[model samples]
Target: MNATRSMLICDDEEELAHELGEYFASLGWHVALAITAEEAIAQLRGGLAPQVLITDLRIGAVDGRQVVAEARALPPALCPALVIIITGHVMHNVTAADLDSDFLYVKPVDPTEVLDDIGSFLAGVAPPPA
Candidate 1:
């Protein structure tokens, strides 16, 4: 099996996006970083499909929901197997369980925890601790 994993990280925080990109790349994954929602959507429309997608709840111009929707609309072969949503905001109407993503994480999350969750997903094991 091809273990060449790929990931796309969409975050409005340029520093955080790049940091996560670097972390994933160092672990032998193809990493794409988008500091804006438009850039991320464009990448997806341009056929840059990844195995995993990590997006912030609120990003420039558009929100993470739009980004995730774009990814989900892609052909099955191009859709990400795992979609992780990270947000610092407490939604007035939506709770964590209300998210339509594979995993929902609040902000102030550690990179290691995200990594572990991804690992568990890929290994077909249970998800990591909340």
Candidate 2:
């Protein structure tokens, strides 16, 4: 069994958030779901520091960049090991510099690819072969 890693997923889309949460949970990861940016920030400030945080860029109010800023503001040991931003508005008013994330994925992303990246981040190694 894999070591139990913790993850925080913040997405306004209920279906996608739950899907990602379930997938990570199945991989032996403890997952937390936040549907709003405020909730996501609250989780971080309330001592729910996870190894990974995956958030949607355009969540209602506060946005993912704010969430990342909040996470980064935490003490080093309390910060997430990786932050990933996902959004449908890839061509919208967003630039790579604005992301401030370890990885960014446009919508319609393959969950498996995200899982692979998560595994790699946690393991501190390259992703496994397909």
Candidate 3:
């Protein structure tokens, strides 16, 4: 993967966001952290284009799905290569049909696993089986 690869992580949990940001940064990725959906949207609108975006499904007032929509609505050149959605809530209300994210993960997920998946994607390799 290119050392300049960048990712955006949006989560209301400050500690988790910071942890993921630091971990990806350590891996030499340009990591951006957003604590709110509004902030995440602002970053995207401000022309911060990341290759990957990982966001919690339920941000304060706006949903992560909204962010996905906004991202997808951007010009082709500005769209993220992948979108991963994370949430602690039950799967009842959330469906892939609604969000159209490349992947969806429940809470308590291993950060390294996420990183590995992302690395594999960027390296043009298939991700290992779960």
* Ranking of all candidate structures by their lDDT, best first: 2, 3, 1
Question: After aligning candidate 1 to the native by TM-score, how far in Å is the CA of 13 from where it should be?
Answer: 0.3
Task: Write one digit per residue (lDDT tens) for candidate 2, span 23-127.
Answer: 888888889999999999999999997878899999987999999999988997778888999998856775645678888889987899998887776677432
The alpha-carbon lDDT assigned to residue 11 of candidate 3 equals 97
Residue-pair clash count for candidate 1? 0
What TM-score would every model get versus the actual structure? 0.87, 0.88, 0.88
Report the C-alpha lDDT of model 1 over 28-103, residue by residue, as the tens digit. 8889989888998999999997888899988866999899999999998788888999998866777644667888
Global lDDT of each candidate: 0.84, 0.85, 0.85
Q: Provide the clash count, candidate 3.
A: 0
Candidate 3 structure quality by residue, lDDT tens digits, 29-48: 88999999999999999998
Model 1's alpha-carbon lDDT is 0.84
